[model samples]
Target chain A: MTTLLVVLLLAIGVYCVAVLEAWIASGRFRLMAPACSAIALLGRESIVPRKPDLLFFEMGPIVLLVAALLAAAVIPLSPDLIITDLATGALFLNAALAYVLVALIMAGWGPNGAYAMIGGWRFLGQLIAYAMLVVMPITAVAMRAESLATTDIVISQSGLWNIFYQPLGFVLFFIAAMGLAFLPPFDLPTAKGELAGGVEAEYSGVRLAVFRLGRMVLVVTLAAATVTFYLGGWQGPSLPPWLWSAIKILLVTAAMLLIGRYVPRIREAHLLAWCWKFGIPLALLNIFIVGILLVVIP
Target chain B: MITAQAIFIGFFGVAAVWFGVVVFRTFSMVRSAIALLFSQTALGAMFLTMQAEFLGVLQIMMMATEMSIMAFFMVMFMMDPGGMGKMEMTHQKRLSWIVGLASFVGAVAIAVFIDWGPVATTVAETAEQTEALGLELLGRSMLIFEMAGVTILTAMIAATSVAIPPMPSPEKTHKDKV
Candidate 1:
């Protein structure tokens, strides 16, 4: 029953954030936008491509949604609200989220179209570019906490949040989070202007809705993770832990959406080169510095 | 009466084998990759049932990313991208089946006959287990791990160099003074 409640709250929170971001990004102010949009989506019939690989085409978005949910499972809303407090919760989240790449590839390839194929390939490129940037900072955080568990990491931040100590790591992780969600500037795979929805081009009705929700779920999960790792997840005074975590998640989501709206999309080549050349090395340096501080400051 | 763990193990074990079979039999490279992913996922589930949470998630993540990369290669090379066209993808099927059967028999025989050691006397808590693992890796095998990391990085650098075709020397322009 507790698990069910946690799932319900997570769904509601993520859905609200998705709707809020949509309204902000488009500058649309219909108060009932989220409900109306969902209703409109439900009424449309899902259309499959003529030569589509039926199994993969259908399973792709489901895989994505499942991945996001699985990743979210490891994050605690409050001390008492954690679904599964696995020892390796932090790494588990990372591992589950990695399935997003596979789902994107399936979405791109299953349609059997040039545009979808390009989009899929583009996602792979994004994966290669941002993967190291994502992992390196997580490594540093794990190093500081001296444990892979998310709860332990949060505990370690009781004295001082990790962001204060590992600000560079925080910055690197935030940028990588944007890339992970395929938000604007890093949204190469589904460039609406160029590939016309990219991997999701062929999807419509329920299928398209699933992909959109999955992406939004990813945004929520990534924000929650950032809060958990850097912002001292569920840790605060005066208010309850869950409420603190929820507020932090909202702020992070708003920031991500605002950045997505304002930042111009970068050229694919430039983004890839910059990530590999500068971002990864900077992350490595952050890790090295944190490691040194941990050893010497102790 | 079957316990939940037993049922879970049995389901995932069968699912793993089923998907493994689907992988080879699928006509399209993309389908094969996705089938392989399902097989990997089932295998990961089996790992989870054993309480090896870290290892299970790691396996899933690694295989997911690896299979996606495999799909990219398949798309680049496969002639029948959609699997709409039928093509003969196998040869000497009878002999191959004989070999496969023999291998399976050998594996089963080994499993049945081998005298495995007793399970650990004391299974440490997960957090302690993780600490021990970290000690084992960083304290005892630190040098080896570092060496392995360096070797892999070197290989990656070599691969990138090899994969990138050398830029064509700026086409000798007739206008350029020799």
Candidate 2:
């Protein structure tokens, strides 16, 4: 039951994201455009490149979809509405999503094209750049909560959202999440202008549909995570818990999608340097602040 | 519930072993790396079945990212990364068989011979276990985790420095021209 609800919510969130993206790209709001596009994609055939790695080509999209779903499983939409509710739910989400790297590398390598291969390798570099930015902020969050449970993290933000409490960590986490999703400015993996769609170059048909869906799911999941971590998740009054979760997730998704349109994509080298040098230190500082706050204020 | 736990443990253990075998059997370096990932993932699941939530999740999380880097390095070094050219994964068939059989027999004999202690049935709840783990990490074993973190950071810095070629000095260009 929880699985069905989360999937449905994720689907809606993805649709909303596509709508927002289309609106941002063009001025018109076409609600049905994404649905039409998905149907069109399903009708096309996924053409395999000659001498391609067959297993990787087949497994990439499926693994991506599974990874996103696995991530969504641990994220609590409401107090009682969580799936599994693992002790290490926060860490589990990170664990489940790590497969995103493997999936992309496989997808990139599967086609055996130069563009795809470069794009795949680019994400590996991106992984090196962003992995700490992702993990470190979560450490600050887990510190404040004194637990790794997603629900506990959310509850810790009840009196004051992590965004307000540790805005530095929130900012770092949000930026890292954007990079992870590879949204426009960070969309080096599938940048259309430079690498001719990069990793998406060789993918087509139903396979392409799955790949695209997987990406959308990823973006939405990251946004949901941002909300659950930074924003007071499901805590606003007048709305039911699930409704608050949905609204917060969608808003975060919109913000994440729209924010990328303004900034230029980060260079791979600069990303690695900045993340390790700037992001990690600030993350440590955030932890220190949170630690002091716990002691001094308590 | 006990039956289900046993079933999951058995399933993941078998899967882990099967994938471990698949790692050796595959001709492709990429496939072998991915097979190792699956083997590691199954082992993680086995940890979960034993109720070590943190260990299980950490194992899965760490292995997934590590394996991709492994895949990258393996493919970079291999002669046929795409597996188009069939290459032998193993050498010295008779010696390999003898070693493999001996290891299996030795493992089985140890398992059977050891006077294993009484089974621990009651397990700590996940939250308590997680809290205790947090305490252990932040309390008793703080230095170890910190050292691990610094070592990884050092490795990252070393890898980046190696990967990025140094900029050529202007003096070198002038000397070459002269």
Candidate 3:
């Protein structure tokens, strides 16, 4: 069963990569067609500039791909089907995500373009801003779950999903995750109008294809994590367990993509300020509320 | 199910060989920095496998981000983009190699000398682990930690704004100079 689950995860990862490649190449996924056309109409071209170093450009996608695979090893598909099942599953997930900064820096520096370099620095700034906010909410959730294992967190929500009790934390976490994932409104580092392709302006061909694929896979992975940690993964009735899990995951992914496509972008500094101000405070408030509820409600 | 010890052993073996190759084959400072970042990531993974959850997260957050930033700085400051130039691997290299070998030997020696014994079973099962963690986090201490985190963030933002270099005046334009 564990072997089957691992294989299934790998297959899904590969499928996500393929879909993203197809989308980037044709700029016309069934769901993303409108956004692609709008972007096209805006006169955005995916150009690869001259004399870019190949190694750095190529490494971005490779690192992202490897991170996704390693992250999968820690997620549980069923009761007994995790590859690693470390006691510190939350830590493992965060650790896996830390690879993104490295990949982004490599992509930015590898291209040897001024815009890409600036984008890279901006991304680092974004990382510092969002990471602090993201950690608090996730850590709050982890503490509320009492154990770090993915399955353990899901089971704790057997009585109630954390979102019901900690909506503020959920919202803060969702926004921070969106920023980290470079979703719409928060994708300042990659804002096409101002920074060309942001960190990836000089990349083309298979390199661009791989990075695009990695982005999609990361989207799916982050959505799955949000579900697993907060929305009660595979806990619904009237369906097989795995199917229920799939439904929840798809719903989150759809919501993420919808937001990514439709929302207007915010300036990088403003976005950081928003996170530091509203996001962090709300996350802290939720933690306090949860603590009070735990003490008084029983 | 593999024991933590076995996992540690496997990771140590792989990491040893990986770092060995990195030290031998890396020709430039930038490549060495990148190699160090990857090695640190591997170490963080090993820490997770060892069930040191907090430490693992800290390791990943600090090491990975710092190493990447170092790599970026090296590229920006150094003239060579590819880092293909010859590097000085002198007395520091020998010291590092000796220290690494000694550490490896010391670790193996400790593992061999320690007595093997039965360990107490964990109270939380795999399924219950996440729930227990959630419940634990709901304690009052976590709230205090969260508050401290916010305060620290505020200070950081304030410092950042103060440190940024101000934009130059428009009077120093090319037209005026001409």
Candidate 4:
């Protein structure tokens, strides 16, 4: 029952984000009726470029969606309420998200176009920039938790969230998360005006729709991860644990959208430079600070 | 219990059929490439199910990124002028058949004979594991390794800038005879 609920919640969350993006694009919020109609409109004909591989285009979205779902399954929503509480949950989550790059590459290669190829290269560059920063912060948090289990990470935060103790690490992680989600300032690969939807430009019809849905789900999963790592997943006063988690996730997702709107997009190379220079240093400093505090305070 | 097993079984069954169709499909090179791309993606998803999250993520990222680049190259350079005959891999008589059978037999032999070792117990499962891992990574041994990563990244930026095309030298106009 709990698994079903979590899946349902995830579906609803992804659907809501999709509707919101469309609404923002079209300037309308007519509730359910218009949202359903808009969703149906997304199914319109997709232009397949000549000599393109239909099988490859079709599978890109499926791979993304399945991976995201499987990753989410391992993340505990509350105590005693996980779908598959694996011993190596953190490693599993990292592995699942890593496949996003593969799917993007496939979509690019299958299309047989110059723009897609460039976009794929750009995406690879972004991955190199952000992966280390993201990993470092998570490592810091994991170190503080002193356990690999997601539940334990939450439990360890009974007194204080990781964000409070490791502010710099949290900031670095948040930035990396935004980049991974292709949100705003870090969204250079699909810089629509520049790359014309980047690697996804050639994809259309149901294939495009699936990719769009996958992106939305990926955003929510990232938000859920931030909650799990920093905000103390399902930990709050008064409200039920699951409800608390949902509320926290919603707030984080909202923050992501806001960042999308306000953050000015940086050039791809410039972003990579910033990550290697500023991001990596800050993350290392954060680890150092945490180490000292753990020794001195304890 | 039944539902969970059913979901799992259904996923595997679908994956098998999907993969088979991709392998048999006679399509343009672009199409075959795309199908191969998706197959890698499906394997990544399978990795997630096996509780190897990090590996799964890496697979998806690597495959998708590489396939996109491959597709882009095909579109940009492989087209015949006026779009007449698209490039495709023709069926080579009997060659693929031997390679496919040999691989299948090898895989079956390995599956039947391979012996797995027992899982080892580790002290890292306790409460201090995270702290210990962090301390170790930040410790002197890993410090140099981490520093090296940053240094290499810096060198990459330097190299890229140096490789950018320089402006062409101006043509020398005929002035007064030297």
Candidate 5:
């Protein structure tokens, strides 16, 4: 029952993200554009490149989708509405997201194209850059929550959200999450102008649709995670808990999608340099401050 | 709970062993790395089945990223990375087999011969276990942990320094041009 609900929510979230992304990219607000696009994408032929690695090609998008779903499963919509409330929910989310690099690498190498392979390599570098930023913020959050469970993280923010308590961590986590989702600015893996769609260049038809869908799901999951970790998830009064969760998640998703369009895509070297130089130190500082705050406040 | 754990343990243990074998059997470097990843992931699952949630999740998370990175390097370095030529994956096969069988025999002998200690009577909840583990790390195991962390950081720095080609100074460039 919980699984069905979570899957349904994810499906809805993905569609909403698709719509939101389209609305941001284009000036129009057509609700059905995403559905139309998916159908059109499916109707097209998926042509495999000559001498492709069939296994990598076949598994790339599916693995991506599976990884996103696995991460989403741990995230709670409301107190009672969680899928499996694993003790290591936050860590599991990070772990599941680590596979995004693998999926991108597979997608890049599967086609046996120079552009795709370079795209994959670019993401590997990106992973090395953003990986610490991603985990360190979570470490601080876990420290604050006194548990790695996502729900506890959310509940711990009842009095004061982490965004306010640890603003540095919030900023770092938000930027890292954007990189994780590979949103524009961080979208080096699929930078269309440079790599000619890069990793997504070779995929077509149903496969392409799956890749895009997985990407949308990933975006939604990250946005949801941001809300859960920073925005005091489901803590708003006068609104139902689920409604509060929904509102926060969608607003976050929209913000994430909208922010990308305004910022030009970043160079890989700049991204890495900024993350390592500025992001990691800030994250460590955030952890230190949070640790001190926890002691003083307690 | 025990039944479920046993079932999952059996399933994942077999999967881990099978994938471990596949890692060696595959000709492609990428495939070999991925197989090892699956093997590690299955071992992580086995840890979960043993109710070591923190360790299990950490293992899975760490291994996935590490294996993918390893695969990337293997593809870059290895000849016939895609296994198009079906090159032999094994080297010094007879020696490897002898080592493998001898180790296997040694492990089995130790398992059978040793008078094992009493089994743990009570199991801790995942959260409690995690907290306890954390305390141990910060208390008894802090030295070892910090040592490992510093060693890894040193190695990473050394590797980067080694891999990067040093740029020639402007004076050297001018001298060359002259």
Candidate 6:
């Protein structure tokens, strides 16, 4: 069935990214390193911390993974390959992804450790920075399409993708997507040197794997959404729509990882200031421009 | 066979009630906040079952963000935030119970007795429904909607200004002191 294939592709996409990340982290860009790492991890014992809130600690990673999958469900792999084509698919994706914040907080707070607590609260700061960055551009895109449905947004790009039109919006969205996924420069919540893995300090073995995998899935979902909302979901010439979707998602993921590796980690305070002072105002201006263009042209 | 909508409504209805109870019963402030989120999420799912997709998703997203913030604030302020001591959080035990039960009974009575308006004979498709709602808001209620948005924006700015901690005053130099 189409649904099963969509799920399979999503899983594989996340796996590929996770592998790529491990390769980067281990100082080796070998292809088989991630698989070997996974095999080794399978034998490790899952550890639960003492004096921790067990319920929330256990629920966190599962919820994060569920949220990622739920967000991905709304994305159309191709014209006929969507899991659920809700009228408000775009909004639903946003809503589902918002819960990732909750899961991160739960993970951070439940561990009852200084590093975990600090990491958890750091994500809140990250959310404050990137939340509007994600929403404003999506709103502008919806305005251009005059519809909230992902399918409709894609259709409006039959001639030209919104990326060409909403260049500023695309740039803002790209940065925020990375931030939301906690990739690279925005990975303050789990900064290894400073917080000793931050929200992930206490997690070990299977739970750790689940949490790490979920984070990768979050990256994959964000990339897929970028392709869906901006690059035009499954719209391409001289190739199958599903293949096009795959290619776009992979390209976006690679770009995020590449940018993440090259960029130095940003200070939390500086990032927050950048978001509030520069990002928010620019996003607002982009919206104003988009509205003017829409009215003037349409 | 039972319809999928009916099944989903039943599931979410029970989940909403269960989590609502959990919200008050939980000893930990963080747990209580998350329980409240679950309760809201279940209600949102119920709305989805009723085909109010936009409202459903809005409810889920808003509650998730709000509850995440609430949980953070609770941890920052509340003592024994992890509930290590398992402290009881309830107050006004007997009087509050009586008041709650009485309010619940009154709400049920009102719900059962009210002569609600007749339901629509037919419902529009999802796209048409959303389009119509959008038009209604932007076309007729445009002024009020925009005003409300502006009001919220102003409130946000005010809150941010108040919330940001004051910067430390510069220390006076010996020359300035002299």
Specify the highest-DockQ model's number. 5
Q: How well is each residue in A177-234 modelled by candidate 3, as lDDT tens digits?
A: 7887787677776778899878767766566666765776677777777877788876
Q: Name the runs in model 3 displaced over 4 angstroms.
A: A1-54, B1-32, B45-57, B72-178
Top-TM-score structure, candidate number: 5
lDDT of 1 by residue, B1-178 (tens): 5778779999999999999998788788888887888899899989888777667877887887888777777767888755777777789999999999999999999998998888543466777877877788798999998999999999999999999998666655533546
**Separate DockQ for every predicted complex:** 0.73, 0.77, 0.35, 0.21, 0.82, 0.75
What is the Å distance of residue A262 in model 5 from its true position? 0.8
Q: Model 6 segments beyond 4 Å from truth? A: B1-7, B161-178
Stretches of candidate 1 exceeding 4 Å from the true structure: B1-6, B120-122, B166-178
lDDT of 4 by residue, A1-298 (tens): 8789889989887766766655555667655743574467486887788866455566767877776787687677788778877655665676667667666666765576778757766876797678777778877887787666788788888899988988888888888888887876777767788888887888777777777777778888888888898989999999988888888887888788776776678998789899888999888888888888788864
lDDT of 6: 0.88
Model 5: per-residue lDDT, tens digit, B38-130?
999999989887888899999999998899889988988998898999986568989989999999999989999998988775589999999
Estimate, for each residue in A1-298, the C-alpha lDDT of model 5 and write its tens digit. Answer: 9789878988988888888888888989999999999989999999999999999999999989988888888889989788988999999999999988889988998999989888988998898779888899999999999999999999999999889999989889989999998999899999999999999999999999999989889988898899999999878989888889888999998888788989999999899999889888998999999999999995
Q: Could you give candidate 2's per-residue lDDT for residues A177-266 as a string of tens digits? A: 988888888888998888999999999999999998898898888888998999988889998998999999988887887787788777
Our model 2 lands, by Cα RMSD against the true structure, at 2.7
lDDT of 1: 0.86
lDDT of 6 by residue, A122-143 (tens): 9988886798899889999998
Native contacts recovered, each model: 0.80, 0.83, 0.60, 0.29, 0.86, 0.77
Cα DockQ of the candidate 2 complex: 0.77
TM-score of every candidate relative to the true structure: 0.93, 0.93, 0.71, 0.70, 0.95, 0.93
CAPRI docking class of candidate 5: high
After aligning candidate 6 to the native by TM-score, how far in Å is the CA of A287 from where it should be?
Answer: 1.6
Whichever of 1 and 6 has more lDDT, that candidate is 6
Question: Model 4, A64: alpha-carbon shift in Å?
Answer: 2.2
Enumerate clash totals for all models, in the order shown.
Answer: 0, 0, 19, 38, 0, 0
